[model samples]
Target: MSPCTFDGALPRALEQIRGAFAGIDFAEVRFIRDMNGRVHLVLPDSADQAEVVAARPHLADALGAYSPGSETGLVRLSDTFFGAALMDEPFLVQDINGTLIRLIERRVVGQDWALAPGTEAGASVAHPPRVSFFSLKGGVGRSTALFLWGRELAAQGKRVLLLDLDLEAPGLGAQLLPDDARPEFGVVDWLAEDLVGSPMAEAMLVERMLVARSPLADSGYLYVAPATGKRTAQHPAGFIAKLARAYLDNDRGGGEDFAVRVRRLLGTLERDLEPDLVLIDSRAGLHETAAAAILHLDADVLLFATDQPTVWEGYRYLLAQLAQMAHIHPAGDDDWRLRLKMVYARASEKQGALEGFRSRAYELWLDGLYDEQPAGGAEDAFSFAETDDAAPHYPLQILNDPRFEQFNPLEHLSTVGAAAIASSFGPFMAALDERVLGNEDLKAVDHAD
Candidate 1:
């Protein structure tokens, strides 16, 4: 008999339960994962109590010490307060070997990271549209692209607000704002203060000290809400302590998670700045907090990548997690997945590079985000062909240029002149303009307050 462990518990229980219940018509079987990552079985009310009793010895042998405190290694759904209504809840399907099992996850942390945000289809949004620049790995020029675009928009006399959400490895403050121009407080300060119910964490404070105007945008307003501010720099010792508290949910304020808090923060900034566009710089890779920027912000997510094996492998993990989202929340008239787009950053000038990248992206999307279309081809199915230019897998290409290498808009503005910037980022900027500014449909989506 195998000793009880987190990974072994599920298969063992499933085998034993199936062996006992053979041809029984059980309504449902739920395997709940506790905080400790232990598996707990919840049999439906339809399960015969007598059969359960008779199978107790066999179940015990399978479950061992991790039997969820049950002698029989199972609990009837009817025994809990959740009762019959629990059956109505949408439980995620988990594949164990070849068998499918319904799973109810009870997590102490990272729940928001796992679950996708709920979006209202075709809802009218009155506020300015938000766009998030994300990459699986750093040094992909995600932030540089955001800065250039925001500056471009500002040059065209449009107000642009850039928020730095890469809290752990904060650079936007130093990148955008000079030492003298750095804001008194920034996003991290607000989050930490708000967590403690500090009076300083008010909307007025965000408007006054959390935002700083950058010299990069000379024509129009270019506001930045960096990850850290001057105060953090001055008190470097306390920065980590504040950062540790920043990601925590506001339990006292009715359980507002990290995503909700960020949303509120964005709303407050929007209300104050009234920017024409909001560009967010998300933390690189699959950091838990990246979920807030990607899914929760209702932003048009541009997944930045290069044609590299490591990039695809990292994306596979992310897309697999997102695939779960695609399954659990069925697509509506306007699918939320449609908001996701690919950005082939630092793309090679080689003839086959773009095609190769697109092919790999299409395969990843098909395996993950894209819906399964029928052979007959339903008109409204979310799936797309490989050649479809409008598909999420179809990347907006940003070519490899030495001029933009180690780029800093503030410092290397002369090296990457207008012509160089245009040549390198022209296609990407044009597409982004059309998507964010020209697309009235995208701007009109409904978002909750």
Candidate 2:
């Protein structure tokens, strides 16, 4: 069968098989689809093999394949067959209705993000810096900050590519793209098409998906890879279904994990667009989807956090996990801490509140990221105090501005003006430009407390 036929056949076949074997007592029924679109049904040895064999004719018919023969067709459950299929690690598996059943631990490929003893930095300076704006808890103006930052960079004549990886709650597209400028496809569309091995060319993928926003049209370009595609002839509501499938480990057998694919996608954008900087709007909290942006992608991570106890508690858990991962698999350099910067959003101007928030942040970093001191007196290569200027734990504070309380990018930009936005977020942006972007001479207002 053709790829299209295979695409529609697998789920239908599984549903039919489930109905056909409704009376059979089986531990679990798994439907596996190989790279070449061939299908296989796996069940525990407890299942009645004779009954399964009897249902072969119906399965073949449902799958639109020739009767079980040497061609690309269903294979009977056997020890040898199972072993061979296991080696290939079929691209995807589903039950009666295309619900992916994850069978393997998702492995992250590429640069590691662990900050521990002996861990070294692996990021290359040649590529443009990819900065991820992340928050443990939502509603902290993470994406809003990203939009303003991108605008500032573009205003400085830097080409920017803004990627929205918040798949479940995508908003960057609507915020950035005007109705007429919205692209037919999006990042998710390209990802889904790539996962399914579509015949679309890479160049076509960039052309169809990357939407250029108006705000950065004058000085520099702002290209966006939104989460969902625009309504078009090619991309319809069915594309949403592809979004659900894109996050699965369906292509593990081919040695391409989801993280690796995400990296490749970003790389492709970099190659095609040649943007000076890439800003990624990552998913909030700790999730497999967030892992690609946080850990695998070689990005300077901007970890946004509030003064809430629960927020810091979440950071503690996340940092502890990273510290442990670092111990197991260290990076090439110890610059993991350097690549990370803390952003305190919705911050208070009161000295005590600011100091209290910074103190709590310092404690979390010390507990989860800083290297352990030697028992004897040994000169440490790097040491940080909460008040140290060069420390990574220093918080870039964005004081609470009622103007940004209800953020709508276009409305805020038009009403507030870039000058006021810059004034409001001055210190944070200045620190970012100096510390993170290596622009030491940029004159910024003293909005820092």
Candidate 3:
């Protein structure tokens, strides 16, 4: 730790510290600012050989808009190893969520970083893909498809934020993100972290929590907001009720404008991490949080359905319910119904069962008896309709694979020789993202009405 030549315009007081540590040939500069807007220095990386590494001046400029840190600052983290944060003098600080930021004394030159050096601009938060892999009835593998979708998206250099809002039967957390790897923090902890918690700014939040590492890809991070907090408390009957509140109530750290909070969180994610998509795997049925959140939040909704009569009946019911709600709200220019995307899962091949289902439904619709007939008119709709059944009327595709045998949430991801359905539904997401907006940018089309 020897004094080195100073050149950058750091304040006069910091110049003395710079002079003392001039021997840091391997210096790495980082910045930390808290919710109250205080700036602090992160000191040098003791491991690297210091040279006058250049600072991120533009990023620095954006960061400097906040006031300098002070001993009596609004709020920030205290790192035992890094000592007390230096107010505006460029010390480290943490946020309420426990994210750590290391503000450099000044931007230095000639050092390598974890991410691309100049690419740090606009590299802020992550917006998890809001994906819904749902089915009208059981056996369609909606959750399983979601697992694959998340894995596939992550494989393409994308950060996937997956949520299991299927409260009554919460299982995805146990499936993909192992008990060994689940984050210490979860949706339930948001309240606890808000109250009796003091988390490390950088490590505890921005880096850890209910979040898990993607074993499918190299260090791909997966953050899941589980339906239940996985509390070991012995409550038997109150599960569903508590789960319902865990999702919709403001007490669980949800704001009055639940939609806006989700938007801001997504915006923060997109800015901070730049994730490709945020996928949500919701529960079945129309009255739960799974339906409410997606019906209100989805940029795209892919409703999965099997080739069974009962399933189709449920599918129709879901659509009707959604349509009913839409009528109540009335579609504005920002209407969400337009973002709906449907996918018929577990479709049987050979066109046998499917054909029978379609022909029967079509005749039922044409006869004006669809309303009167029980939704589940046939045993396996595909049977009576197919063998030579007509084409499907709406959005439907055959996922006729045996991998969907039972309740296996993870299937066919690594199957060497299986007849998996080939689908281009992945690209379907981009179009939907373009449609459902984080913010609407309405430019007038020049013309007369």
Candidate 4:
């Protein structure tokens, strides 16, 4: 059916389509800026108006953005952003299936969500929800954080999959796959062979992942998808124009037919892996690879920061650049801000700074609230900048213990679990571990007798 949202003015609604698909990829985007402006965007290899409209609600829901009706993709907003007259429409197409297939997800209304800043009154608290630890800055300890947190969850018996999306820099492989252990194939190899759809598959792929013995080893399962680290050495002349080249290309880096290949990989993981939680330690930083992961990957984001001011500053700076890539927000019932679990490392030595920060943060927030509402109850408090005015801005669980200082909490947090991790990262990680992994349904993946 023609998008249910359209009123039969296909030519009229084209200009506004560009803004809606700002993050989507297209081959040729030519705009006719005339009386009847048309936004003609040629898809990479696959997509069509049907796919875009069908997936609009799903995309909106997944991104936690402004939700639209089923035919949302058909509606567009004027570039002017002038309140009302800015709505336009455009058509979408698919030359190939993007890594993320747009689908309609049904949500019930029995529960409602509200997103309000400062009030902190609305929103749901989702713990143990999947988070892909990512960094715009590589070597920022994304994998390490993923492993530690996974171990924390595994210890609680919550099934977890440490899905490795770092196709190029495969850290988990080095961490899990031992030098002596040999396997005939890896995820990249299997993917290249398109072995996933087969019914009679041999040896489970997750089982094949290199496992590092940890007190938190999850019986739940942690699979590592090893990237080939394979860079196509050469691009054939006019590969894009060659229809035959489509299936053969896997690298999406301006050359390979990445969308199809990636979708296959994601599909395999989603179905075959069958994990309760998937923690993707994404490829370091903001590349096309990372963009795809961020926009399409189904998980909240856990951004890491070291206690070092430089680390925090660098990350904060890069966050602005990343903002343009996707709808970034922390997970929460009503507010997305909560979904962003900020991990401040080396909190032990930074106690003074942390205290100062919280104190200032509280005061600042109070002031802002007061500004927004002159009669606001927090007027006397001075907002987040002053601790006195803040609503107990969650304490900076200092990871003060020297064991954690060295970045090795396993020894300190072993069987003792919670108490051990708290020694370094403050009570933060341990508390998070408890909050996410200690649900009634979870019984300790690693601690299971």
Candidate 5:
């Protein structure tokens, strides 16, 4: 098949190949898409190349491409071959139903997504307060909450940078930027251009990517590094291609991994804009971008959750993975646990709703975060209980408000007014100010109705 046809045709090909090779015991099968977008099927060394070539007709029919005498686009799965081609890794893995793939791409920085033993310990603690807003599932108003909180901070005369890391479903740019104010370049553009060794200097890239929001300018600076470039059909052409290329590692020059580049990107923003707080709108669910924000960036993570079974289950998996990391590198002076806080979004003030949600969150935190102590023993000074007011796992509630139901920062700012927004999110903002930002004197503004 042509490269264009192979763009999104992996599932059908996997099903057909599985059916064709049924009952044959193969060690491993890999699906690789090369730089030119051509798809290749990889098999273990034990498989006969001639057999694979003989099955070319079936493979071609499955792939919807007939490239004769091309060895059926088959390659041996080996370290050397894997290293030579600049291709995406772990495209699909074999499962009972043929091949299973995540709806969103997952990127791992190092081996098996685990950091080195001393990496976390050596992380810089002097950077500006970086806060990540995350949710296991969407529609919890994660990004909305971030926009409101960021505006509140800026209004309090604190410089803030709202970063849109949700590249797949970007909305912050539209939500915050006016038609004339949108940046010419965005995070994806910078990464893609850098990958291709563009001559644009770092200063120029920052100038074009970080655009200031005029609405918040009078209070304090609020700059946004949106996910995509200006909202025009002509601009950001080949967005999917740019996204695919952006995720690739810088193996040639700086040799920085994707996570490192992201960190550096934030660092550049912080340095250039000199924002007091950098609030990142992390991608929802378990994605590479989300992992980079949560695991690599030395940021205070505010995990947003609603009272739902699916949300809890997803959080359970995420926390369990984090718990393993905590176990591997037990809490030290600068541990990541110190930076985590839970936010219960869309919380109702009904008799038991808040408590019930808090209870479930506490249980998850206990299982996935808090280090267990010996039974009937004196607890460490820092040991956390479900009810501890000072514990990072404590749930900060954002009471339900109809005004925020259909939240749009630009529209709501004028309609609902900042006072109402602040009042609705009073407790959450207070907790964030006290715990994360270390701003005790600053309070949310109370505009008169």
Candidate 6:
């Protein structure tokens, strides 16, 4: 027999098992795919024990080296923990050639990414509303938009907290915080220490060591939580060590996942700082941690794109993955999809470019996120026309500006003066204010020439 790989393991096992028990009932059987992508089968209580025993060799052969021992490939549901404990675990009805199999998958990463938020629309607590800036490709000006929006809100006398959830690339700290003004610890330290039940996490959270005030804001506040902090600056070598431990599961409290821990941390920061709003700079691309900011946090997620073929293709994959969650177990509110809006970053002035981008985006949303509007069905279906300005696919435009090419807010403050910033980000910020602050009367702060 040939050795089985991950892609072929499930189908081969299903064929072998079905062949071995041709007439047996399999209504309660489940195929479990563990974190490491190994396949195991659990038989229902009604299964024939003698048949299961006799088919062990076939199962072993189907699973190949994965079933090194007699007990590894198969188990009785009644005799194992999977029966009761995994009754509510999410699963997909996968087709192996022609046979349908209920596959329960458990993965250490991307679990939150594939699932939609379970809460109703606007049901979150009274804490400040979160807005995450995300992009599939880097340097699309996602972080710059976050900074500009935070500054704009702060200028309007609103306390804004900017979180750099881009742990791997760690740039927001140096962008805003000067060397002497850096905080003692930052988000990575808080997360890593919290996983091990360290008091330092609480200390850092409570004492403002995890956040710093940016001099860029003089009126209100632009609080920042960088991925790295003063300790990282002092000992650069240990930064990666802390980062490696940051994404681990939290063992201290009910075995919380990484997303839950991030939400808790955000709650702590909101309570401590009492910001008017929170702007999170999410990690660009589909990194595992990006799920926390994009899906789990009760945040309005802004997806950035630059009208490139690669950009649309990347979004196609991301949205198609989300489509699975919507079709499988849609939240009762149907508002989660609305929480995602498109941003045409570095948009061109030519109308052709704008129209082409919008058309492509609308097609993607229609295929992946929008509800199907059947004739004579619900008039309130969550579908929108291609030209609907209110649709999630209709992007808010940010004009291309050469001044922001290599923007450093601290060093190039003159390059992005009020007029320049308003010209580039006016429409985007206006829409953002309406979404976050409910200011419908607001318009673009300045018009681009």
Write down the lDDT of every candidate, Cα atoms only.
0.80, 0.66, 0.43, 0.41, 0.67, 0.81
Question: What number of backbone clashes does candidate 4 have, counting pairs of residues 3 or more apart or in separate chains?
Answer: 56
Rank list by TM-score? 1, 6, 5, 2, 3, 4
Which candidate number maximizes TM-score? Answer: 1
Residues 1-449, candidate 1: write the lDDT tens digits. 65878778878878888888886433388777767766667787778888777777777667776665545257788876688777765455555676877666676644555555563222234568899999998888888899999988888777789999999988788888998898899889999988877888995364478988998776678899998888988999999999999988787545776877888788878887788789999989887889888888878999999888999999998887777656554445457788899999999998899999999999999877787789999976788889998889999999889877777776887666889888889899999999777854322222232
lDDT score, candidate 6: 0.81
Most lDDT-accurate candidate: 6
TM-score, structure 2 vs. true: 0.68
**lDDT tens string, model 3, 87-195?**
3232322121232233332322111111111122222233344656565554566776666656654554456677665655666666665555565544434422333
In terms of lDDT, the poorest run of 10 residues in model 6 is: 440-449
Give the CA lDDT, 0 to 100, for residue 401 in model 5: 85
> Can you write out model 6's per-residue Cα lDDT over 1-449, one digit (the tens) per residue?
67888888888778877887776555467888888877888877667788788777788877876654456577777777656676566665555675667677678764676456753233365677899999997888888899999988888777789998899988899889898888998899898899898999899987789988999886667899988888988898888998888888877545767787888899888888888789999988988788888888888899999998899899998887676566454444456777888999999998698899999999999877777789876765778889998788999989999998878888997656889888999889988988778953332233121
How many Å off is the CA of 227 in candidate 2?
Answer: 1.1
Off by over 4 Å in 2: 1-126, 201-203, 206-208, 216-218, 232-236, 250-253, 328-334, 376-383, 440-449
The residue pairs that clash in candidate 2, if any, are 91-250, 119-333, 120-331, 120-332, 120-333, 120-334, 121-333
Clash number for model 2? 7
TM-score of every prediction relative to native: 0.88, 0.68, 0.49, 0.49, 0.71, 0.85
Q: Which scores higher on TM-score, 4 or 6?
A: 6
